[model samples]
Target: MQKEYTVTVYTEDRIGITNRITIIFTRRGINITSLTTAETEIPGVYKFIITVMSTREKLDKVVGQIEKLIEIHRAFVHEEDEVVYQELALYKISTKSLESGDIERLIRDHQARILTITADYFVIEKTGHQQELTDFIKKLEPYGLIEYSKSGRVAIVKWSRRFHEHLKELQASSEA
Candidate 1:
């Protein structure tokens, strides 16, 4: 049976690394539902959290293939229930089309942050699950949406009290 999986990949920041990683999934016939990449706290390293659908066996193979990439430092699949996840979405609305009262009500109802405002448009930012953002977009579209951007899901497994020990182990292995 196919199950959804989110894999976190840590790799050296180099051109084409993302393409190489995604190509592995494409070759295996797995479609990526969401993929996000950003620089990690460790300088010159990038992290990717990719969401895909596949059986456990296929997911494992994908991770193993990612591990073999020259630029990749580590790759592992995270259990969804064991991780914290969030996504960011930003939408710009035409200020002339919506009344301030209605706009405030919508923002309050959705818990969105007012990012900026000009005479013509208002930019709002919201962060949460993908479903929340989708619903928000639906509600705001009628208000004359100008633009939008979404950061794909990013997640990290909850760390235990012995997290430092695990980090040390990872550092040692990487340095070896």
Candidate 2:
């Protein structure tokens, strides 16, 4: 059986690293649903958050292969419930729609905020899981949405001690 999984990888900053990491998934014929890469709290260390649909068995193997890369410091696979995640979405809607009774109602109901208002359109910003963000779109359609953009998922593993903490633990064990 196949289910969604988020694969998190920590690596050193280097050129062409994204391409190299993605090729691993491509060669395995696994379709990546989302990919986000950003620098970690420590400079020169980057984290890659990737989502895919696969069985636990397949994903475990994928993580192993990812860690085999010389640049990778660590890689782990997580089920959705094993992590905390969020995505951000922005919607641009015609200002005229605001005139329609209670546009404020939709905004409040979705817990979204108007990012900016202009002569033509106003932008609304929302952050949540994918389904929540998609739901906001349906609620906004009647208000004459002009544009929509969403950022890839960002997540943190639930059962984690900081990566640095883990490193310290390893060092302690080695010294003992």
Candidate 3:
């Protein structure tokens, strides 16, 4: 059965690394739903958080191919429940809308914050699960929502003890 999987990849920060990783999925016709990349706790190492819908069998093969890349340190496929994750979304709305009391109530109810207010428009920021962010979008539409964007998933594996140990080993080996 096909289900959503979060593929976490750790790699050395190098040019073309992302292109190489995405090409693996492209060849297999797997559509990446979302992709986030950023530096990790270890300097010079970066992490890619990719979301895709595929069977575990196929995902495993994809991960293997990713691991074969020169700069990749490791690649992991995790079921949704196996990781803790969040997505950030920002909404731009007309400043006029904020004048209404109902809009204030709505924002407060959703626990979203008004990031900036100006004469023309204001920005609202929200951080939550994908569904929660989308739901918030729906509520803001009637209030003159101008634009919106969401970041890809940022996640940490629920069971990361082994991962930490592996990183330590890599550091030790590199220092020798």
Candidate 4:
């Protein structure tokens, strides 16, 4: 059966690397649910976090192929349970909706907080799983949701303890 997987890749910062890495999935008919790229602790190095739905066998092979890319240093595939992930969502609603005060209750119940309140709109921020963010949207629909934005999945492998060790290994290998 196919399941959600988060593929984490460490690589050197270079142009077109994102396109090159994503094409591998595109060719395999894998649809990416989320993609996030950012700098790593190491200077000139970067990390790519990709979320996809596929079977373990296929994902293993895909990860192998990703590692073969010239710029990729390493790639790993993780099951949902193996990683702790969150997405940040911001909701902007009309200030007129607050007169009822029900919106305040809903935000507190959902563990979301108001970030800013202007004469026209108020913004609420929530950080959680995808389903939670979607649920919040449903709850806010009655409040005249002006804009809703969410960030890509940011995750950390629950069992990862070798990150530093792996970085050292990469450094040593690059030096040799």
The parts of candidate 3 lying over 4 Å away from their true place are: 172-176
lDDT score for residue 32 of model 3: 99
- For candidate 2, give the lDDT of residue 100: 72
Model 4 C-alpha lDDT per residue in residues 69-160, reported as the tens digit of each score: 98988899998899999999999999999999999999999999999999999999999999999999999999999999999999888866
Q: Scored by CA lDDT, what does every candidate get? A: 0.84, 0.88, 0.92, 0.92
- As a whole number from 0 to 100, the lDDT of residue 55 in candidate 4 is 90
TM-score of 4: 0.93
Candidate 2 lDDT over 130-168, as tens digits, reads 999998888888889899999998998887677767655
Off by over 4 Å in 4: 169-176
The residue ranges of model 2 lying beyond 4 angstroms of the native Cα positions read 167-176
| Candidate 2 colliding pairs | none
Q: In angstroms, how far off is 162's CA in candidate 1?
A: 6.5
Q: Each model's TM-score, in the order given?
A: 0.85, 0.92, 0.95, 0.93
Residue range 58-156, candidate 3, lDDT tens digits: 999999999999899899999999999999999999998967778999989988999999899999999999999999999999999999999999999
Candidate number achieving the greatest TM-score relative to the actual structure = 3
Residue pairs with clashing backbones, model 3: none
